[model samples]
Target: MKAVLPSITSDLDQAERDLREHGICLVSGVLSAEQLADVRAGLYRAAKLDNRRKLAHSGRRIDHGESNQHVRNTLSLDPVFADVAEHPAALRLVRSVLGWPALLGNQSAFIAMPGCEAGRLHADQGFIPEPWPTLPQGCNVGWCIDEFTEENGATRFVPGSCRHHRPPGEGDEEGSVAAVAPAGTMVVFDSRIWHRTGENRTSDQSCAALFNWYTRPIYRTQENWFLSLNPRILEGASDELLTLLGYKTEGFGKVNGRSPM
Candidate 1:
């Protein structure tokens, strides 16, 4: 019901606590100024290239004039993207909720262009059947590349909605609040939390965030790394990166009843 989510500056312990209590939290100053600029530039460049290649994703709400452009292949576009994906605090929080075997489900740019309609209110786990389990099966880490404000379409979330154990509906919009934070903050939340992009009222500024989704190992990943990952990345991937990508199989993911690694 508050105007914004709770935030902690450079405190991993508080971040985990916030996630458990509020279902969402912002970790400020997670990225340096240089990192912020580089990642932002990489996102735009990848988006431009994808647009040119007709591979960009724009979810059009025709009647509502929503044309949010999403760049889905950021992992293959730049090394900076990869660097951000492995951010220590972000990954640690992810593992704390989803466990050490959590797999990186998807990493993409969530951009709200000018005049865009607010995104539909729903939980990230909406795709899965309800009544949901008490423990989260997945989580989202949204890296704010640009300072988020109400005017420029910061993401909106329903605090403590994770305990609802189900997806939100039409009347659930009343208590939602925008996640307004400075650039370089990482907005992390449980998959069951109700959230969506707020409307972008600004004429020129576009709210951009790199969203890295992590899931429990049992679920299928949103992005198919085997088919979509760049060969160069695979060739040089560390053991941890490989594990995150599902290339390093564990108990259930074994190939021919044997570990891939």
Candidate 2:
């Protein structure tokens, strides 16, 4: 595999700044060709695992007819996925946007149905009952494993939608932006931004890995990652990464009572 950058710098700095201001940023070619291949290999491996099954839960389920598959808890399934989850470019961008001391929350793989229709437009952070202007809570990184496009059901977002206090209505004339990129490009955006999965008009299933990050210590993650991790995975992870994955929660006292033991 190719060597990863310690952090994103120079032109990426400007791109990050623009994302912070607009509540969304798209970084093309963030994942190298080798890295992309590794991710694809890992995903295909996970998909083929007998133990790796589809989630029974239907709320987030996509209508795949015979092939609709939504796979979860991938971090524990393979080390290759763990590496991609903690990719340097993704980590650097998360830190730059949310400030230091962020952790991964709600990591999963989305394998969508070819003819699936559009999903409801809503902000991931809307579930939080707290008032506005609070510290930045979380953001999500969408790693395109396959080519994303309007025809293949790419994610749609409304620019500057993060500033809205409530979810957008059905009649709202939202300015839609499709996350169109080749395999390996990653899209990072604030959790507060309004977005939805677009309809898939093609025969191929759209696949992407979703990695969410948060600055606060105590919020419930989108995925229960602790229950999904194993000792071997923990041993191989970096100190910073271990903490991000909830292996060691030092500063988490601000949210969860007492440090994570």
Most TM-score-accurate candidate: 1
Once fitted onto the true fold, the runs of candidate 2 whose alpha carbons sit more than 4 angstroms away are 1-10, 50-68, 213-215, 251-261
What tens-digit string does per-residue lDDT give for candidate 1 at 1-261?
254578655788988888888888789878889989999998888877877987665555311443577778688878788887777888899987888878888898877889878888888887788778889989999999888999898888888788888999879988888888888989899999998888999999988989999888888888888899887877677777778888777413878877686
Clashes of 1: 0
Give per-model TM-scores: 0.93, 0.82
TM-score of 2: 0.82
State how far residue 258 of model 1 sits from its true place (Å). 3.8
Q: How many backbone clashes does candidate 2 have?
A: 1
In model 2, the worst 10-residue window by lDDT is 1-10
Top candidate on lDDT is 1
| Model 1 stretches with alpha carbons more than 4 Å out | 1-4, 57-66
Residue 223 lDDT in model 1? 85
lDDT string for model 2 (1-261, tens) is 421112222357765885667766777767678877877777766665623444423354533343334556667766766776677877887877676567677566765567666766777676677565544467788877888777877777777777775557786435776777667767787777787777778876655545444554566666666565665777657866766766565434423655454
lDDT of 1: 0.82
All predictions: root-mean-square deviation over Cα?
2.2, 6.2
Error of 1 at 185 (Å): 0.6
